[model samples]
Target: MTGATVRPVAIKLDDAMKARLKRLAEARQRTPHWLMREAITDYVEREEKREAFRQDALKAWEAYRSSGLHLSAAEADAWLEQLEQGHDIDPPPCHS
Candidate 1:
Protein backbone atom coordinates (compact mmCIF):
# COMPACT_ATOMS: atom_id res chain seq x y z
CA MET A 1 0.00 0.00 0.00
CA THR A 2 1.18 3.53 -0.69
CA GLY A 3 2.30 5.53 2.30
CA ALA A 4 -1.18 6.41 3.58
CA THR A 5 -1.01 7.60 7.14
CA VAL A 6 -3.13 5.47 9.42
CA ARG A 7 -4.26 6.52 12.87
CA PRO A 8 -4.95 3.96 15.59
CA VAL A 9 -8.35 3.99 17.22
CA ALA A 10 -9.30 2.02 20.33
CA ILE A 11 -12.78 1.28 21.58
CA LYS A 12 -13.96 -0.38 24.76
CA LEU A 13 -16.22 -3.32 24.00
CA ASP A 14 -17.84 -5.53 26.61
CA ASP A 15 -17.26 -9.29 26.51
CA ALA A 16 -20.47 -10.13 24.61
CA MET A 17 -19.89 -7.43 21.97
CA LYS A 18 -16.28 -8.53 21.51
CA ALA A 19 -17.42 -12.11 21.01
CA ARG A 20 -20.02 -11.01 18.49
CA LEU A 21 -17.47 -8.96 16.54
CA LYS A 22 -15.11 -11.93 16.44
CA ARG A 23 -17.84 -14.27 15.22
CA LEU A 24 -18.93 -11.83 12.52
CA ALA A 25 -15.35 -11.27 11.43
CA GLU A 26 -14.71 -15.02 11.10
CA ALA A 27 -18.02 -15.53 9.27
CA ARG A 28 -17.09 -12.80 6.78
CA GLN A 29 -13.54 -14.17 6.37
CA ARG A 30 -12.04 -10.87 7.51
CA THR A 31 -9.97 -9.83 10.44
CA PRO A 32 -11.61 -8.00 13.38
CA HIS A 33 -9.46 -4.98 12.56
CA TRP A 34 -10.68 -4.96 8.95
CA LEU A 35 -14.29 -5.26 10.06
CA MET A 36 -13.93 -2.37 12.46
CA ARG A 37 -12.31 -0.24 9.77
CA GLU A 38 -15.09 -1.01 7.27
CA ALA A 39 -17.83 -0.39 9.82
CA ILE A 40 -16.35 2.97 10.78
CA THR A 41 -15.90 3.98 7.15
CA ASP A 42 -19.50 3.07 6.24
CA TYR A 43 -20.88 4.88 9.32
CA VAL A 44 -18.90 8.05 8.62
CA GLU A 45 -19.97 8.12 4.96
CA ARG A 46 -23.65 7.60 5.79
CA GLU A 47 -23.61 10.26 8.53
CA GLU A 48 -21.78 12.76 6.32
CA LYS A 49 -24.39 12.42 3.60
CA ARG A 50 -27.18 12.83 6.15
CA GLU A 51 -25.53 15.96 7.56
CA ALA A 52 -25.11 17.47 4.08
CA PHE A 53 -28.76 16.79 3.24
CA ARG A 54 -29.85 18.38 6.52
CA GLN A 55 -27.79 21.48 5.78
CA ASP A 56 -29.28 21.77 2.31
CA ALA A 57 -32.80 21.44 3.71
CA LEU A 58 -32.08 24.17 6.26
CA LYS A 59 -30.77 26.48 3.53
CA ALA A 60 -33.82 25.82 1.37
CA TRP A 61 -36.12 26.62 4.31
CA GLU A 62 -34.30 29.85 5.02
CA ALA A 63 -34.46 30.88 1.36
CA TYR A 64 -38.18 30.15 1.23
CA ARG A 65 -38.82 32.21 4.37
CA SER A 66 -36.86 35.16 3.08
CA SER A 67 -38.16 35.13 -0.52
CA GLY A 68 -41.52 33.35 -0.19
CA LEU A 69 -40.66 31.19 -3.22
CA HIS A 70 -42.12 27.72 -2.95
CA LEU A 71 -44.51 25.22 -4.40
CA SER A 72 -47.76 24.55 -2.58
CA ALA A 73 -48.25 21.16 -0.92
CA ALA A 74 -50.79 20.16 -3.54
CA GLU A 75 -48.36 20.98 -6.32
CA ALA A 76 -45.55 19.09 -4.61
CA ASP A 77 -47.77 16.12 -3.95
CA ALA A 78 -48.90 16.03 -7.57
CA TRP A 79 -45.32 16.07 -8.83
CA LEU A 80 -44.27 13.40 -6.33
CA GLU A 81 -47.28 11.23 -7.18
CA GLN A 82 -46.49 11.44 -10.84
CA LEU A 83 -42.86 10.49 -10.19
CA GLU A 84 -43.94 7.60 -7.97
CA GLN A 85 -46.14 6.32 -10.79
CA GLY A 86 -43.11 6.37 -13.12
CA HIS A 87 -44.33 9.28 -15.19
CA ASP A 88 -41.71 11.65 -16.55
CA ILE A 89 -42.85 15.12 -15.56
CA ASP A 90 -41.09 18.40 -14.98
CA PRO A 91 -40.94 19.66 -11.42
CA PRO A 92 -43.64 22.01 -10.19
CA PRO A 93 -42.75 25.68 -10.32
CA CYS A 94 -42.04 27.60 -7.13
CA HIS A 95 -43.87 30.89 -6.72
CA SER A 96 -44.66 33.50 -4.09
Candidate 2:
Protein backbone atom coordinates (compact mmCIF):
# COMPACT_ATOMS: atom_id res chain seq x y z
CA MET A 1 0.00 0.00 0.00
CA THR A 2 3.01 2.27 0.27
CA GLY A 3 2.98 3.24 -3.38
CA ALA A 4 -0.76 2.85 -3.96
CA THR A 5 -3.10 5.77 -4.31
CA VAL A 6 -6.04 5.83 -1.93
CA ARG A 7 -9.27 7.80 -1.91
CA PRO A 8 -11.52 8.60 0.98
CA VAL A 9 -15.00 7.09 1.03
CA ALA A 10 -17.54 8.17 3.62
CA ILE A 11 -20.16 5.95 5.24
CA LYS A 12 -23.06 6.98 7.45
CA LEU A 13 -23.62 5.08 10.69
CA ASP A 14 -26.25 5.44 13.37
CA ASP A 15 -25.25 7.02 16.68
CA ALA A 16 -25.25 3.69 18.50
CA MET A 17 -23.11 2.03 15.87
CA LYS A 18 -20.72 4.95 15.81
CA ALA A 19 -20.37 4.84 19.57
CA ARG A 20 -19.76 1.09 19.48
CA LEU A 21 -17.09 1.49 16.83
CA LYS A 22 -15.40 4.18 18.85
CA ARG A 23 -15.41 2.09 22.02
CA LEU A 24 -14.08 -0.96 20.22
CA ALA A 25 -11.43 1.11 18.53
CA GLU A 26 -10.33 2.54 21.88
CA ALA A 27 -10.21 -0.93 23.47
CA ARG A 28 -8.16 -2.26 20.59
CA GLN A 29 -5.86 0.82 20.65
CA ARG A 30 -6.65 1.49 17.02
CA THR A 31 -8.43 4.16 15.03
CA PRO A 32 -12.00 3.50 13.95
CA HIS A 33 -10.80 3.96 10.35
CA TRP A 34 -8.31 1.12 10.76
CA LEU A 35 -11.01 -1.20 12.11
CA MET A 36 -13.32 -0.36 9.24
CA ARG A 37 -10.56 -0.94 6.70
CA GLU A 38 -9.65 -4.28 8.23
CA ALA A 39 -13.28 -5.41 8.32
CA ILE A 40 -13.85 -4.46 4.68
CA THR A 41 -10.60 -6.10 3.57
CA ASP A 42 -11.42 -9.35 5.35
CA TYR A 43 -14.95 -9.42 3.95
CA VAL A 44 -13.76 -8.80 0.38
CA GLU A 45 -11.08 -11.47 0.61
CA ARG A 46 -13.46 -14.08 2.01
CA GLU A 47 -16.09 -13.30 -0.64
CA GLU A 48 -13.47 -13.53 -3.41
CA LYS A 49 -12.37 -16.97 -2.27
CA ARG A 50 -15.99 -18.12 -2.01
CA GLU A 51 -16.67 -16.87 -5.53
CA ALA A 52 -13.62 -18.69 -6.86
CA PHE A 53 -14.75 -21.95 -5.27
CA ARG A 54 -18.23 -21.50 -6.76
CA GLN A 55 -16.76 -20.89 -10.21
CA ASP A 56 -14.60 -23.99 -9.93
CA ALA A 57 -17.63 -26.09 -8.99
CA LEU A 58 -19.60 -24.70 -11.92
CA LYS A 59 -16.76 -25.47 -14.33
CA ALA A 60 -16.39 -29.00 -13.00
CA TRP A 61 -20.12 -29.59 -13.32
CA GLU A 62 -20.08 -28.37 -16.91
CA ALA A 63 -17.16 -30.61 -17.77
CA TYR A 64 -18.84 -33.61 -16.23
CA ARG A 65 -22.05 -32.90 -18.15
CA SER A 66 -20.20 -32.69 -21.44
CA SER A 67 -18.01 -35.78 -20.98
CA GLY A 68 -20.24 -37.92 -18.77
CA LEU A 69 -17.12 -38.78 -16.73
CA HIS A 70 -17.26 -38.93 -12.96
CA LEU A 71 -16.58 -41.06 -9.92
CA SER A 72 -19.23 -42.63 -7.69
CA ALA A 73 -19.43 -41.42 -4.09
CA ALA A 74 -17.86 -44.69 -2.86
CA GLU A 75 -14.91 -44.29 -5.19
CA ALA A 76 -14.28 -40.72 -4.07
CA ASP A 77 -14.65 -41.70 -0.43
CA ALA A 78 -12.12 -44.54 -0.81
CA TRP A 79 -9.59 -42.24 -2.43
CA LEU A 80 -10.10 -39.66 0.34
CA GLU A 81 -9.70 -42.36 2.99
CA GLN A 82 -6.39 -43.49 1.53
CA LEU A 83 -5.09 -39.92 1.59
CA GLU A 84 -6.31 -39.44 5.15
CA GLN A 85 -4.38 -42.58 6.18
CA GLY A 86 -1.10 -40.83 5.20
CA HIS A 87 -0.80 -42.57 1.87
CA ASP A 88 0.38 -40.47 -1.10
CA ILE A 89 -2.13 -41.40 -3.79
CA ASP A 90 -3.61 -40.08 -6.98
CA PRO A 91 -7.32 -39.76 -7.55
CA PRO A 92 -9.00 -42.65 -9.31
CA PRO A 93 -9.72 -42.18 -13.00
CA CYS A 94 -13.15 -40.87 -13.87
CA HIS A 95 -15.52 -43.18 -15.72
CA SER A 96 -18.95 -42.93 -17.31
Candidate 1 stretches greater than 4 Å from native: 1-3, 85-87
RMSD of each predicted structure: 1.8, 0.7
How do the residues 2-73 of candidate 1 rate in per-residue lDDT, one tens digit apiece? 799977878999999999999999999999999998998899999999999999999999999999999988
Instruction: Give the per-residue lDDT of model 2 (tens digit) for 1-96.
Output: 798899999999999999999999999999999999999999999999999999999999999999999999999999999999999999999999
Looking at candidate 2, what is the lDDT of residue 90? 98
TM-score of each: 0.86, 0.96
Model 1: which ten-residue window has the lowest total lDDT?
1-10
Model 1, position 76, has a per-residue lDDT of 95
* Number of the predicted model whose lDDT against the real structure is largest: 2
lDDT of candidates 1 onward, in order = 0.94, 0.99
What TM-score would you give candidate 1 relative to the actual structure?
A: 0.86
